[model samples]
Target chain A: MIDYQLLDALAAIVSEKGFEKAAKKLFITQSAVSRRIHQLESMIGEPVLIRKQPPKPTAIGKRLLNHLQQVRQLEVALSIRSLADENLQDSPLTVKLAANADSLATWLPEALMLPKAEKVCDFRFEIIAEDQSIALKRMKAGEVMVCICSNEEPINGGLVSALGAFRYKVIASPNFVKRHNITSVEQLTELPCLVYDEHDKLQHQLLNELNKSVPKYTHICPSSEGFKQAMIAGLGYGLLPTLQLGDAIEQGELIDLVPGYFIDVPLYWHYWQTESPQLKSLRNFAIKVASNKLETLA
Target chain B: MIDYQLLDALAAIVSEKGFEKAAKKLFITQSAVSRRIHQLESMIGEPVLIRKQPPKPTAIGKRLLNHLQQVRQLEVALSIRSLADENLQDSPLTVKLAANADSLATWLPEALMLPKAEKVCDFRFEIIAEDQSIALKRMKAGEVMVCICSNEEPINGGLVSALGAFRYKVIASPNFVKRHNITSVEQLTELPCLVYDEHDKLQHQLLNELNKSVPKYTHICPSSEGFKQAMIAGLGYGLLPTLQLGDAIEQGELIDLVPGYFIDVPLYWHYWQTESPQLKSLRNFAIKVASNKLETLA
Candidate 1:
């Protein structure tokens, strides 16, 4: 059996980036931390960390850290169960989740504001906003407890739920529409297009459906908020999430380029197959709220 | 001497997260990719990757990848210098940078729009929006070529420049201010505060300056845009960046709480000491633009 304390020390070293900082966090001496790491390495019969300026974990160390995190989650669940009647007021839970940038900027806040999600207040959330592909990869790597992603297929031993579709409409500032006189699909190639990034194919996907290729000039704004702001400021035209554009569109700040043409990206929720009440509560709340917010395809 | 081809294959595998996908990216067979990785491990006399579902690089692998990226950058610089008269239109340079979210949302855009920065159109930019601490860490790790951060100290073998300061003021929606009747610092604890995240100390920093503790109720909106929107929607008060708040305040959407109390966070630019013309151009352009945009300290 592996000693969890030694594993914890190894994880701390990687996360805190040094033995001294890890020792400070763990409230132990640096020598104690080093000894624990050494013992763990001896037990595994291999060095688990590179003692560089900022120490990094080896592949075996990463596996050990991953195992430690899983064990920690189980322990937290056990503690919560044991103290069921204590209301969990004193001990606040921390939930680490991976999500796409668009979701975080749009309906996610409202979803978290749902009455059932008030429990979210009792928890600290570490949200890692990333592209859908990267988010899914992080989820599969056990880096996050849950993920809101575009991947429909669930990972092995994980629960997956359909959270409806996020519809994106090709939109631009009202001024940009008037200046460019963009009415037909062919004119789109003449005007500059705004893309989220190189890997972002939303603009291309829409253009491909309309049998149009990407324009020569394109502005890439990586942040979802920056992308919207750039569009609002008449930087270029691109697909904006319907949920995020409702207010802007209503205020006439943004105008849909081609009416009745939109791309609906199906989103899914994936969580670990665990008996943790907090995870179950969050997953159910998210699905319920996302279902209400996102467009449902019949 | 390390084989850059094998190193590239290893980096691709770690980044793409799968052997098949890495193979596809390199335009090589999956078996060939595996053989290169095997050869690299044999050459290094140690395994360089963990064969997990989503493969991860070992410490040695990570160092090798970092070295490979640095070498690639130098090679690109050499090629650019040799083809100086070719106008660099055919070959687009890529500059990876790290910056705070607030900078990305506000002044950074205008800085990128500067006349000198028009040449930036020739380069592809990968701007990673992260906190100052994390940004500094990534710079130190050599993951990013340059970073806009709060750290004034230059990293070893790097250059640092002061980019003036970003001023933040306590701001609330007009309705929220009227509803709460917040006139004194003592009443601040009664109202709910909006924070970007737990790491965000702007609110706390302001409160600390005024000798006040944090409120009992606080709302965490991690995104810079979301934080501003939440304030505009009367969710809670927050320390809004002066650059972002100008339009909102002028439009009467948000009101400043204290007339004089504002915090100015000094920002610095850190980049590698390199003879690369692209790096020099970017550094000079960024410094010139940021100096003009940010508030200079007397």
Candidate 2:
């Protein structure tokens, strides 16, 4: 039982970063913003903001902000549904989501292009490209309304839907294979390999399957595009997503190190289990698109 | 006083995520990897890694990994210096660094291009497009050896160098400006604005300076390139870095709302305080290049 007005004030203060600015954003007086925050703190029985130069929300405050944002989103969705004008020009629905870089560069745009999503909603998409673990954390923290992550488990009462497998192949530029005379896993050990990040386990998984050791030297490129560019530049060989590799493979810019050996990373769509029509539409669209775009494990 | 061998085994385990895989990576038996970890733990009197599926490092373990990585970089740098063949085909020094997205999209490439860096080091860059706060946290956690961040303060004995100011101008597409009939800061509130993330303060700061309130709605695109693309697509107005906006502005894609009202975010380069030659070269190059590229306040 929270006051939407007070919550609005809180969100504005956090986003605008101070009482003075928050007051202006809400079109209220500075004193009003202060009083509202004081009321919130009194109700919560704890300080919400650190009250620094650029004010930062405390852990509890951050959680409340997340809560407020979620509530606001639900309200927006409800309003969208209640509107009689089906042809309303501006849908007023903003969806904040997080996804991995590979998805952002590939199937995500297609998934978002579902007719229902495009026609009904004036979709304002705020997409954050992050690692699966970080994306999951953001979703749990309520920083994002939805997250495309590898984790199958749902948290904070979120709904989880399978998005099929993202298959990866150990790939290198044609020049690298010929220059290193790499025909086997043992040869790969002597050459530098490219990794997405320290948290990336795909290369190790491939080597494990091959019964080969990790190379002493490795190149790390945290961005999906950078990883691909590095491989194309002959910096190192790496496990690249099939979605991203198709163009390069067709162009003959890259060659599969071992054609038959591949790893399939299963992806899941996680979203808050809400009755909002917008969320339902998004969920259905995502599932349908992912199934079509992602590789099937048959 | 720490055994590099045990640390290497520990790093391998954390990166590879299993004792068996770590053993294979280290070219040792699984029993030996286990024995080394056990010996290291007994010496330290604490567990270093969480023995879970896809293992994670403990707080102390993460710090040790950072330390080991730093030590390895120094060893490589020293070896490069000692090599008799100055024209050695490939220098083995790999530098792992973190930088903000704006920097990565702008002046960082030129900084990395200094002749000494290219010739003497085989750069393995992990470009993390993170905010200054997160970038600072990662640097403090020893996740990166050097970071180009906005934080002026030094942490964990890291050296800090001023890398001039990154000037930002509030801009919008010509079409957006004409559609909204935006002529002043007061008009901005009626339209949607673009934000880098929830933590983005530049828009608020601009509004505060103009004595205006923040808009009720904003479009958040966390990636630098995406932010620019959104603006180009006439999504919203935003405070874009001058470096990123140069070509767009020249091509008549964007127009500055207020000619003189700009925010100059002072950039800083922070790195571990080490006498490593590789770090020295990188720091020097960054300072020189940043001074030439970034704007300076008189």
Candidate 3:
């Protein structure tokens, strides 16, 4: 049987991303952390960590991490059941959730705000900002307890539920529209387009449907607000969530390049089947908030 | 002599992160792109790109990329100089910049608004969000031409200048303050702290200065706005930019755990010494805009 203490050392090293930091976090000596990892390696008869600037786990190491995280979920549920005496007040559980930036820019904050209304304030969350395409991979790697992603597929031992959907419309500043005189599909290929990054293909997918050629010029802004600001500044034109446009379209600050056309992006909440009761209810609350704010796919 | 076409193929492959995408971007067949890379590899006597799912360039390949990007910078300068009679109106130059998320969350948007004020809008920008420590690494690898970082040391063939500064204050929501009764440094360690990510040492550094122990609980939010929202939601206390904390603290929604105490973060612009005239002027405009908005380091 593997010692759980050794596994905790490995988890801490990966979580903190360094031995020194892991030692600080675990309140142990740096060498002690190293010794625990070495003992684990000796027990398994294989090295678990790749010795790099910030170390990464080997394949078997990743499997170990996944198992430990699931076990942790069970422990968290037990703790929540024992919260009746208010024993777990000071010790807030650190939970990680992976969500795309676009959702975070609009309705996810409101979903997170549900905890405040319910008076469930015993959790500290790390909202990992990731592209929807990559968020599920992070969850599969056991890096997060819950994920808000576009992929509907559930990982092994995971449960997924529909979190409603959002629609994106092509938008540009009034000054940009007037400057470029964008009137047709061909003109859009000629004008500059903005994207979150190369992984972000909303612009590419939309443009391919309209024109044969990819965007002649592209701008990549990795931040949600920054991308919108870039759009509002007449830097380039690209897709924006209709929910986030708020008054930009009506106030004449932004023009929907394609008024009726939209690409609906449906979101799914992917959580561990063994997710703690607190996070499970939080996930349900998120779905409730999302359904209230976002349009239904049906 | 090595062919510039081969180098361009290598660049497009890396920029687009795949051969198929590079083929589309370069308006060449995939085989033609492959042949160019093979030719370049034969010339270098080493593999330029690793054949992974998303290809990565070798170290020597990075040196070659740095060289080509510099050449491209010169070409852009030439194009701008020859921009008489609006000849180059249709073709916009693509520029990549690396920035810390904190700036993007605050005054960077204002700084980016300069081009519109000056009627200079022929460039497309891709702002790569990264931690300040890691931003320089990407810039050094020639992933970006211009970088906004906290690093003071100038890289080879790079120019550095002050881009003003900002201050951070330790704050929490009024409810968090009341619930935790955080009146002393001891109480701080007892409460949870928030950091941008594992790469973010701002919270740890501040707490290390205040107390010998690291934060007992550290929540990591990777996005700028998400991090602030996590703080505002009373998930944890953290170091937030004073500029971003405006109204939240004054409006009685937040309380400064350390009143009048602050950590000033100075920013510097790191651009290539061979920066184009167009970009140089834009960089100067950013500096001017930043100076007007951000506080002086002194």
Which is the leading candidate under lDDT?
A: 3
Give the per-residue Cα lDDT of candidate 1 at B172.
89
Interface RMSD of each candidate, angstroms, one decimal: 3.5, 4.0, 2.2
Candidate 1: segments with Cα more than 4 A from true spot? A42-64, A85-87, A114-121, A174-192, A212-218, A250-253, B1-98, B114-126, B132-164, B171-204, B212-222, B228-238, B245-260, B267-298
The 10-residue segment of model 2 chain A with minimum total lDDT is A110-119
Chain A only: TM-score per candidate: 0.89, 0.88, 0.95
By summed lDDT, the worst window of 10 consecutive residues in model 3 chain A runs over A113-122
What ranges in model 2 sit over 4 Å off?
Answer: A1-79, A83-91, A100-124, A131-218, A224-298, B17-20, B29-38, B50-56, B81-91, B114-118, B212-215
Model 2, DockQ value? 0.19
What root-mean-square deviation over C-alphas does model 3 reach? 3.8
Candidate 2 per-residue lDDT, tens place, B1-23, comes to 98889999998897688999999
Of 1 and 2, the candidate ranking higher by lDDT? 2
- Residue runs of model 3 more than 4 Å from their true location after superposition: A1-64, A78-86, A113-121, A182-186, A208-214, A246-252, A255-261, B1-3, B23-51, B79-86, B113-121, B181-186, B208-214, B245-259
Best candidate according to DockQ: 3
- lDDT tens digits, residue span A59-153, model 1: 77766765666777788778876777486654556667777878877766545433532453255456677787568766655567778888888
User: Best to worst by TM-score, what's the order?
Assistant: 3, 1, 2
TM per candidate comes to 0.70, 0.63, 0.85
